[model samples]
Target: MSDSLTLIEEMLGREARLFAASNVESDDRSHRTYIVADFEYQYHRSAHAGYQVAEGAAAEEKIRWPFHRIVAAAWTVLRFVPGQAVPEIEAPVVLTAETMDEKTMVTQFFDALAAMPQAIFATWGGEAKDLAALRRAAVEHDLCLPVQLLDLSPYSIRRLDLCNASSVMAASVHLPEYAAALAIPSKPSPRKEIGQLVENRQWDLVADQVAADVLTTCVIAIGHLKSMAVVTCDRPATIMALAEKAAETFPKSIFCSRSFRPWARDRLRAAGLRGTVFRAP
Candidate 1:
């Protein structure tokens, strides 16, 4: 792997993903996948040049969704089985493609998700942004999309928007703020101008941003699971150890990758984790 790729892989996580930390009591609760995901897209600057968007109204209409091209996506999979302390967490696998070849990116993303048993797709505010972009991309590419991705109903069980779920659509709250409030470790002022980065084809930086965002959301999802009593831990150290145990099982290439030591040290921190190191048996 090139230096940039190595850096990204190290940041992304080991192998495919890690584990889900769920609270289902049903017989079918054997396995549930918490797929936290985020996508970055580039839009037609030629079409919207010099156009300022109105915040409250017409914002949706002003930013034409049809011109969107999904350039990159970060998929974080967390697989949790009842009675298991940690669900296999496939935190993030970054995918990148040219705007014209968006079909390939879209295809691989959903195809991989489809292959996962009992996947629940998630995003920050994907219902309005990511999902719509995907639907439009599918239309343009003539691809069959999963109904779960297309469904926007609040009653829909398969897709979840963490932003809406946690805040009830409070205008001031976003993923970063939510992470901060929860004491989730985040580098202050991470770059979020993903569209700009995507336009420049800076996929490495894009991956950096997207991957970290997915990680934050995954932790948040774990927080939700804890609140619902799906996952019971004596404290943050317990969660940390389980996550480390899961990471230790990953392939050697990723297992020995850089940044993992520090990455592991920081997680489930401030938000509820005490950073207790877990010793493997």
Candidate 2:
């Protein structure tokens, strides 16, 4: 392992030990593990030229359509011991294509995710973008998606999309912006510029960005869980009332906007209420 990875593992271990020591009541509790993941893709107009032309479109129109190709993927598993305040962190895992081949990169990405079975996989905007793109890419590449991700269910706990949760709670759904709002550290490489780096063959930079994104995702998820555990409310109606009051009190604040919805949903879910749908009064 790289020195950085080793150091991260040490840090996680230290945190785990400290948590155990502080929460002695949970010493004998059993825990489940969940994986937090993020993926970065490069979109190129050249890859879809043939498909575009086949649809009877002019050459100029064909250039407008781009194909999204998975270039990097990163994930980390968290140990969720029952009665613990937060999950135990683990060193992140990253996958990238050495040759910049989409098929190889996509295959490896899915394979890594598939390796972790029975573990909840979480991501930011994964359902609408990351996983959706992956599903399409896997089909194009003739690759089989993991069963956990392929299951089409409204309440599939196997994969949690933090972005969707944020949307449900009416919070800012943008990953970097949301992370910033939560005071999480910034990524080494900005996600917006990653595609340019990929085009320039800066694999190292891409890997660094992916690593940072995945770690940030894990941190955000932990924060979400922690926040949910501390909420005291009777029903979604009460939470919505409080949200409206906050909005009226602080019009320019994120807490007063749609961004508050996801946070509210997270708390509601933690309170054993079904938070998948948000009903407005």
- Say which candidate scores most in lDDT: 1
- Give the per-residue Cα lDDT of candidate 1 at 26: 37
Off by over 4 Å in 1: 1-27, 47-62, 98-100, 187-192, 231-281
Question: Candidate 2's residue-wise lDDT over 108-136, tens digit each?
Answer: 66665555555567888777667777777
Worst 10 residues of 2 by lDDT: 230-239
Candidate with top TM-score is: 1
In model 2, the runs with Cα more than 4 Å from the true position are 1-30, 56-66, 83-88, 169-172, 230-281
Error of 1 at 244 (Å): 5.9
Candidate 1, residue 153: Cα displacement in angstroms equals 0.9
* lDDT accuracy of residue 122 in candidate 2: 83
